[model samples]
Target: MYRKQLFLLSLLLMLLQTAAFAQNNKLRVEPSFWWTGMKDSNLQLMLHGNNISTMQPVFNYAGVEVKDVVKVNSPNYLFLNLNISGAKPGKFNIQLKQGNKTVHRYSYELKQRAAGSANRQGFTSSDVMYLITPDRFANGNPKNDSVKDMADKLNRNDRSGRHGGDIAGIIQNLDYIKDMGFTALWVNPVLENDQPKVSYHGYSTTDYYKVDPRFGSNEEYLELSKQAKQRDIKLVMDMVLNHIGSKHWWMDDLPTEDWLNFQDEYKTTNHRREAIQDPHASEYDYQLQTEGWFVESMPDLNQENELLATYLIQNTLWWIEYADLGGIRMDTYSYPDPEFMSEWTRRVMDEYPNFNIVGEEWSLNPAIVSYWQRGKKNYNGYVSYLPSLMDFPVQNAMVEALRDDEKSWDTGWLKLYNTLATDFLYPEPENLVVFPDNHDMDRIYTQLNQDADLTKQAIAYILTTRGIPQLYYGTEILMHNSEKGDHGIIRTDFPGGWSGDKVNAFTGKGLTKEQLDMQQYMKKLLNWRKDAKVIHTGKLTHYAPYKGVYVYFRHNGPEKVMVILNKNELPYELELEKFAPQLQGVKQTTDVISGKAYNLNQSKLALPIKAPLILELK
Candidate 1:
């Protein structure tokens, strides 16, 4: 019995030693894998482990070499600069050692690139974007609604809480989206937010390399891309490069002091957008605007750090290649350092020449937005390779114009006309995203004062305008925010997204007559516009608003579409002679909405009150 006890004690000691060694050798390598034949041969691997900086990395793979090992201020982190110039698609072992004693061994993989990945086409003006808040869209998989490891659990009652929407829901509803005539799907950030509260919106990224488990797995996100592509629908990912959640794993052990902006002394951003363009703007203001934390809960990233920049760039490329994204909607474009933004855009564009990236610069001034487009000639001599920008100026103008009752120099339709006139500021004006409203603003229906006619007019304007058009989810059924600017209310649950909801938008169950009509009208407009190439890449011309009517024409070589918006309470008679330049040879026209034929050669045109007439002329 004593001999057996001694043997048991020896076994326990051996097990304890193994546990200690495992704990000491625990290592984390980011970008777990990479691809061969990339445009850039250089790859920077971020390694994190206990006292990893004290170890030497050994690579015995052919065509792969560790050019340099950089040890930062933190002993727990090591940056390995590797050159994979002639490396083929295969796996190789990288072992970390402390003076010939192997501490940890990792098998790194180099994946094969997909065919034509470098030349994938991105979303364009011809595609209509459907902006969806995933949490509010649909709950397809209830099993993942509450994850044990995730901080925020499912709370359907809380307006700002997670509501259990996952990529499975999106994959399930691709037909509904495709049938709705939206050629592109722009889902708000699906990355891991993993915060304790307010994690539904997904802006506060906790893990750059992971998809939020509460929503779905990384494989599920990739499945969405594949399924969406099969239906001829493009996927545009919303990316936040400015800041991350305070609860990020790195917060406990930062790689370096400079990995974040304003590390020690906490400072909030000034939100002075003009500082980026104001030539005489003080360096202090510029630094505050670009480097300051967005909010106390959000820690700003420091793109100025070369290692951090490389990591961010690699993360973006990995997502693009892994998920097969069609485009990227970069959040808070102007909030980052301009130099870094330029370099980031240039590098991504270099790899995928046909890919599109639209930056969000929430400035009402055209000059501020124009400065970020790829080919803009800024007076300050600043250059940006960003291909597109959110047209906030046009959106704000459209809302204000629809709400005004009277026509004036700066009010009513003139606001929209003048806003479009500023297109000269953009090198590719048609690339801008024109929208009636977005997730951040009140619904277009509410902005139009609940007037159905005005709502239809706004939709027609954006769809026919000289830019890519984006529609917020549930806009077809005229969803509203009774709380006005309340973001949570504005991004409310889609009526039929849940299983037991009273109304089902998918099936058109329990809907009012007005809602049904609006949905049908939107369906027709979008389906018709899908094949309208004139409106896609046409030349636009507008005549000044007379009385309460505004008229515009979108024309190509042989196709022409004339849009007339009558905002007056009473019917108006318009003289066709005034539009002889566009209508002289046209005799017959069809109203796209009403399906009624009109003789354009007649002396006067009769227009119904508050009706938007989109006529295709021959």
Candidate 2:
């Protein structure tokens, strides 16, 4: 018994020693960073440690030098700048010495990069982005619910509250997203919100440098990107440089007074995105609209400050390099200072040649939305490097057509048809970000007055027509806001997200066959596009609308996909021989959604009421 007690005491001592070593062995840094440069660039590192204040670490100096050591605001931090400019290339070791003691020596390898090895920024035509509000998606890890020492974690039950959906939850559901035929996933800001409550949305960032612990560590974010890339899915980061949450860490302890646009008082926005192209908009209106806070709880950022601008731009680049993300979705694109925005886009694109990004303009007018695209004849002459902007005009027209009117002049269906006719306003109409409905609004099914056929038609149009289509998560299985038509209910959790749930979308358990069919149908149509480049990169051609039916063709060279949507209840026969140009006497083709056969040249192809068909010519 004495011998057993002695062993237990020995084990306890060993654990104590290990704990002490771990605490001491930690090579800590603050305002974390990594090194990535155009060619050979300099890197400055700041590490805080005990008894290392005056210690000069030896480095292999692949053309590097320990230029200087400076004290930081915190006594524990010591900044070290390494001059990599014009330095020789070789592997190096970094070790610190304080009198007689030296830290565990660490080795780092540096090598000359080949030409054109650096990544480039720009988006492609063959990409589909799945936008997710990190907080509302899922609470995969509950341990981070109430992190102390930073922000207060309160009730998630509040509708305007934070629900603790972190980056980890998003990482967990990547497989589901990839399976759904989405090539890219956009997560709303994962940075520290630091708000006392309702930070689940993450739009109110306090610290640009720190990853919200509630979402998992920054390393976890990098892991999500790595895992997603392995699955052939690109991660698109949703960035908000316009404004921040009022409770951001910088609110009280700002890096500078100019860190925010209006630190003393709030400015309101005119919200006239059309003002950019508006001939009569006053200067005051433009200033207010672009400078105003999105809300009382949000503080506008000051892009005019060079330091703040640099910080924001650097942070974006850092995330791209660290996470290896495929794209970026900038929120409130028009609100930030236009000059800085152009510079930001240019710099980002300069780094990543093949990257893709989409900015949200949220204007229902084509003139307003088009003004933000890459090439535009703005009266102000704002040159933007942005690849694309959201097609809010088309989305608005579609919803209005399906919900409100179908008439002679400004009526139903006509709104959508006419809107498409104005596609000439856009420099590249096919490169727009086309989304039926998003987080701020009702589900597409609900917006269509629960008309499943109409919903199907809209999906078919967006997917097969032009641009890239983004669908909300629950839209596939016909989830709707039928009872009260609330957005919260519309964004209800997918049954398969939780374990032991009565319904399982993954397994099709406990769901009606109709629900299952809708899910299967969407999967079939979208997954088929993975190989359907004819529909993706094809040119679009359409004639004037006629008799409640619209026909458009997506053609590339010899490959052509004729898409027709019939809004009429009864089938309206088409004069295939006369009007169907290139498709003359064509009969056999495969249905994109159902793999059904169709004889286009035969007696008016059997189409259901408001049916949407995609015929792949044989």
- The number of the candidate with the highest lDDT is 1
- Candidate 2 residues lying further than 4 Å off, grouped into runs, are 1-31, 36-117, 120-123, 150-156, 482-490
**lDDT tens digits by residue: candidate 1, 1-618:** 999999999999999999998876689899999999889989999999999999999878888888999999999999999999989999988899999899889999999999999999999989999999999999999998998877799998888888888889889999999998999999999999988899999999999999998889899999999999999999999999899999998898999999999999889999998998998999999999999998989999999999999998888998999999999999999998888999899989999999999999999999899999998888878889999999999999888888886645667888888888888889999999999989999999998888888999999899998999999999999999998989889999998888899999988999889999989998899999999999999999999887778899999977899999888888789877789988868999999999999988789999978889999977
- What pairs collide in candidate 1? none
Residue-wise C-alpha lDDT for candidate 2, range 492-572, written one tens digit per residue: 666665545688675678888778878887878778887889878999887555666677888887888888777787766
Clashes of 1: 0
Error of 2 at 343 (Å): 0.4
lDDT of the candidates, in the order given: 0.91, 0.74
List runs of model 1 lying over 4 Å from the truth: 1-24
* Best TM-score among the predictions, by candidate number: 1
